[model samples]
Target: MSEMLEVKEQETLSETVPVFGYELIREVLLPDILGEETPKILYWAGKNLARKYPLKSASEIITFFKQAGWGDLRVVKESKNEQILELSSEMIVNRMKTNGKTTFQLEAGFLAQQYEGQKQVITEAFEHPKKRSAKVQFTIKWDMKDFA
Candidate 1:
């Protein structure tokens, strides 16, 4: 008489999973592939992504960033045609501590494109990395006359 071995079924569960080592893609591979044009390319790519995921309001946009692992996005100041935003996170702080020259061009471009669509005007964004504060700032500006 031969004994048969019983097989166990694998567990199948659904849950939200966090992505790890995204910096390797953002900080290393992308720059290596794009070379000198990394910043510009990433900026345009971010704008393209913003078009795909059009958020209705600034709060929604901020929520999107948090859900997408971008960080905490907050409007520090807003004027007639200009908006200043700050982004901070544990990842950002760690990156700043380890790397002195981190760029946030992708975030800048995303903000620029989103603002342009929301205001129906041509918009531009500049990124300022605060190494000391371990944060990144974005300044989005638009001209009143130029309609998008």
Candidate 2:
């Protein structure tokens, strides 16, 4: 199982897919089907995905984001109970330009779940999309006294 997971992660690292298909589903089809609840549903879906593909550390989470074509993620700041991460990519820029209502809730939820798994604490994440900068900032926070 571990080997298969490793292979799956590595396989997509260098693979490329046409963005049109991805956009067609994510931007068009999903919104059409999910309607106003799309962001909320996608956020929960991301958390479920994290559960299925748990990573042991922050580095692994970063790699997973890249492999999954989310973006280039970097830790901007870290403190005792919170961490700030920034995500950017050409795809992100394009999405922001094309869709004014773009949301990064999915990535935010993924980060929240990943950190919860790693820290064994109750964690939550908030997404701040900077349309002007074409980047998304994720603020992941955990209650030190709360355990998962």
Candidate 3:
């Protein structure tokens, strides 16, 4: 009975939301305002977070993205039963600059850097470090068509 209580406690703790900020930055706020570079870092962060939580399929990942308010998840090119998912967020163009050299920047340099600092499980840079503004691309490949 005590073991059950302990498990319950852990579950409760994990579901608790903080009053400070979100663990995963939403997809909508990444691209335009954050710059072209943010999509990759956000995508990587989303992937890592999904793995940590371990969703059964890509659709589940989409749902997770939606629930997080990242943005509208869309399948751009679907071949056979597999498709590529593209996530985008609205960006405030004027807010894209940072004062630091490389590390101070977010989205491309800053976003990737911060996501890297999380030590979650992401290590891939979506774009070249020097160029923080680029296309936002994330590919989701799977065979489950009706997955949610």
Top model by TM-score, which number? 2
TM-score ranking from best to worst?
2, 1, 3
TM-score, each model? Answer: 0.86, 0.94, 0.35
Q: Cα RMSD for candidate 3?
A: 11.6
lDDT to native, each model: 0.80, 0.90, 0.38
Candidate 2 clashing pairs, residues 3+ apart or interchain: none
> Highest lDDT: which candidate?
2
**Model 2 agreement with the true structure over 1-148: per-residue lDDT tens digits:** 2355589967776877899889888888999999999999989988998898888888988888887889999999999999999999999999999998888888988999999999999999999999899999999999989999
Tens-digit lDDT string for candidate 1 (15-116):
333434677777778878989998899899889978877766788778767766779999999999899999999989977876565678888888889888
The alpha-carbon deviation from the true structure for residue 131 of candidate 2, after best TM-score superposition, in angstroms, is 1.0
**Tens digits of per-residue lDDT for model 3, 32-111:** 46676664555555545434444444464455444444444455565643334454543211122321212211223322
In model 3, the number of clashes is 10
Candidate 2 contains a number of clashing pairs equal to 0
Error of 3 at 10 (Å): 16
Q: Which stretches in model 2 have alpha-carbon errors above 4 Å?
A: 1-4, 13-15
Pairs in steric clash, model 1: none
For model 3, which pairs clash?
A: 27-70, 28-70, 28-89, 32-91, 33-91, 33-92, 105-110, 106-110, 106-111, 107-111
C-alpha RMSD by candidate, in order: 11.2, 1.7, 11.6
